[model samples]
Target: MPLEFVHSPTQQTFDIGSRLTRLLTLLFSLVIVFNTIFAFSVLVNLKSLDTCMFLSSDCSWSAHIDYIKDKAWSRVNILRSLKFTLDRLTLETINMTFIRPLLEYGDIIFDNCTAGEKQELDKIQHEAARIVTGATKLVSIDKLYSDLNWQPLSDRRTNHKLIFMFKIKSNISPTYLVNLIPLRPADPRYNLRNSSDIPLIHCRSTLYYNSLVPSAIRAWNTLDSSFKSADSIQSFKRLISNTPKVPHYFNTGPRRLQVHHTRLRLDCSLLNYDLYRKNIISLQACLCGDSESVRHFMLFCPLYTSYREDMFESINLLVPGTAITLDLLLKGNVRFTDPFNSQLFSIVYSYIDSTKRFI
Candidate 1:
């Protein structure tokens, strides 16, 4: 690709600038110099890269969103090729490597794109989740993300945006970007409650609502005082882990059987009910004669009563306050901390595996 000159954009100015695209002169000399000197250089092509894809007469990237969408789905389609070959964990890692960077390429700017735009990107994430977990198209997109313990692209963008905002506040980002972040003025007379936080940029235009400055500031101000007090960006990044986009499962034990648990959670297992629905069997009834279902299989299956009894006993001993329920055993609970939840999942899956229900 050859150098293409671009003027610094004037409108929709509150943006994630130079993160990918920068105004480079069309003069071939500078291009050659940059190419030779820099270890990494992206050819300045608006159509080739998303950073400059936002360029339009109206300053709306909505025009190029389709390009980004198609590009992402292409990458996802490539991941789909490995759907059957790789395990969930490996597939997820590959997805993060190939697809996530594409989706998040310029999310600080994409963060403020229209809902339709965000939804398009989200579809890619959901599709990746489906591929990674081996879930069918019938699985709920949210459910796929939940089972995989992955954040939606929107939440992930918010996270990256907050981190970027933090960098701007710390004066590590570009001067133009840093200058855009306004700190709340300190005044003694009637110091209001939220005075410690940054101020929001009031804008009348719906387009401005998604501007990087206001959106980042809004999310930044919502942070806890402790988060704001962090001296280094690393600590702040670590703290972000406490807030998951989707509630995470402890997900312990061998990785292989986790999918079995997911099948149970999604109720897409080889249970007689699912089998009957697929017309694989004449009856949905269990050998014990009740309608074969998740509740029946996990809770009341007389066949697995012996293993189920031990699983419940371990859960009760581990977390007494937790009420015994299908969800608790299947999905675990948010109230249970990470370590406890791991133990809970271990017990539940242990019982399920012993039953050889999905084996």
Candidate 2:
């Protein structure tokens, strides 16, 4: 190999440059191939990320929120289309049994949602309330909520979060949520309003404060002693179900009859002649010659004389000296006691059934 006499410097430089260019080209090709394979892998494994398969500790909630919104809105659209046929009770049942479960499932995602997103989600529930109760656009949301015996979505979310925390604290739930929440001794001398309470650790980030542990701690700390002292998860759930503010009447009467009574309470029934004035129906109440309003039909109509006596007897038994006025009949202004309210509902349901004879 050392037999060559001499070589030109320019030729040697050119040969070295050619070899270097080939090496650079091979390296660039490998880099492109690896990049393409990585991109493909990301696309293929995208779905696994939703359930936190790869990143268990720091699961992203945005995807979960998107999924909920898409699913909830689709159901809402279906419910909206069925507004004319289903009555308030049936609609509420569909919401509680069907749509509500969808929202409540994996609700931890809601904790990460912004206030605006929460409100957007709540609007779907608001729309449902309007559809079920036959409330017009002008009806106040508060009135519809009270009549329907529904809790606002925000409150529901809060309740779910608190309940979840209670489960974790009581060792009923086996999840990583326990690591975030810590138990502290209650100060007996202070006489805190809430008996079963947990101390909240100060968090530097708003995200941490708004998370399941801290937010739940805050909510659980504000609950009354009776609720905090529930012995089991079932007992806790029962106490929450019996909360006076949001009453549940599923056991009181058949749903179909309950709907009739609900319609009467809202004064938006198909039989109401007031709907005819608004061009919603063709016929007015025949007996009165006036607009067959709920007040006229329920109170003043001579047609219901036989049934009216029984209705009054039931009402009096429920709440003695309870006045029957336009506002009371329409808006349910009087607050009858528990079993009384149930009894009153039964009376109203019977009265509604009696009126069907004339139709």
Candidate 3:
């Protein structure tokens, strides 16, 4: 029989109410089980700490130790919720890392609501799950889930009542079962926070107007080998004062050119397709495609090993013992000095820019 044809308004409402109640009961049971599991995990992990001992009021312990304890407690709550729901509801044992613990908290509170209240809570949770599931991250969820060996739960194998329960307990969307997954954060229409605020109003005119120069000056001051003497200070100020005037780049202010940092060189070469490619791709080593990240390209990719070989030789000339990891470069430990560093940075930036140009 057709679903609509079989439905009586009174019977339909009763069925809906019954389905909702069962879902709530299942979800509530899950939360209790999850909480117990989480508490046990924490108790086991923190066995080293005496439960009877006073937590120190000392500032150092208060700052670091207390902060860790609070984070652990929050994790305990979420894990406990997951364990509780899974045990009572007969859910397939899937890895729980993809689940958001905070949303799990919301789900626990949601299960206790009245039928009408449950509907409202469901709406809120669905929306929140939509936001979080569609959030901006270093990697794509589809790719990440595939890598993590997550199998989509089918409605045929799974209980329809429990499907509703999954939605309630996991705070997850039922959309995945239908093969409709979200676009990643990189996509323009991806339903996540995708835009940053463009500064329209300047809070401080002088600071805003000379934003580039001031940042450079501040960066120079912050360097490990910062300019100290009066002569050095004068030279730094001269660099700031002599920057070329940008045409309304930042309210049409003049830019001062200080000592030639490779960062400034790269900024100036943003339009240079080759240099931009290398720099941007290098910077994004941690976040690029499955096998095409900066790390993979620099240290591992046979396709780009020639570039790595050249860069390594250059580094060996300047600072002989630098690792090729992107982290080491970002930390300024990888011998980024003078013409050698500048040439290397430009090459990498140019490579990145060239790839982007073709794309």
| Best of the candidates, TM-score | 1
Candidate 3 C-alpha lDDT tens digits along 1-359? 65566678999999999999999999999999998897677446434322221234431123332333354354444444444233211111111332223223323212322345334323332322222222112233343233223322221112222233223223354555322222224534544332321112233654343333222233333333322222343453443333332211111111111111112222222223223355543432222333343345435656555556676676667566655556443223333444444444444454443334223
* TM-score: model 3 vs. ground truth: 0.20
Candidate 1 Cα outliers beyond 4 Å, as residue runs: 1-52, 186-188, 243-258, 270-288, 298-359
- Lowest summed lDDT across 10 adjacent residues in model 2 is found at 46-55
- Residue-pair clashes per candidate: 0, 0, 26
Alpha carbon lDDT of residue 233, candidate 2? 83
lDDT (Cα, 0-100) at 37 in candidate 1: 56
Which lDDT tens digits does candidate 1 get at residues 269-349?
778897778777899999899999989998998999999899889988998766899888877778767788888888987
- The superposed Cα distance between candidate 2 and the true structure at residue 252, in angstroms, equals 13
Error of 2 at 291 (Å): 13
lDDT of 2 by residue, 120-239 (tens): 767778877877765655445776777767878777777787688778878878767687677667556676554446777798988777877678878888877778778898888777
The better-scoring model by TM-score among 1 and 2 is: 1
The local distance difference test score of each candidate is: 0.74, 0.66, 0.35
The per-prediction CA RMSD against the true structure, in angstroms, equals 19.7, 24.8, 29.2
Instruction: Quickly count the clashes in candidate 2.
Output: 0
TM-score of each: 0.64, 0.56, 0.20
TM-score of 2: 0.56
Give the CA lDDT, 0 to 100, for residue 27 in model 1: 56
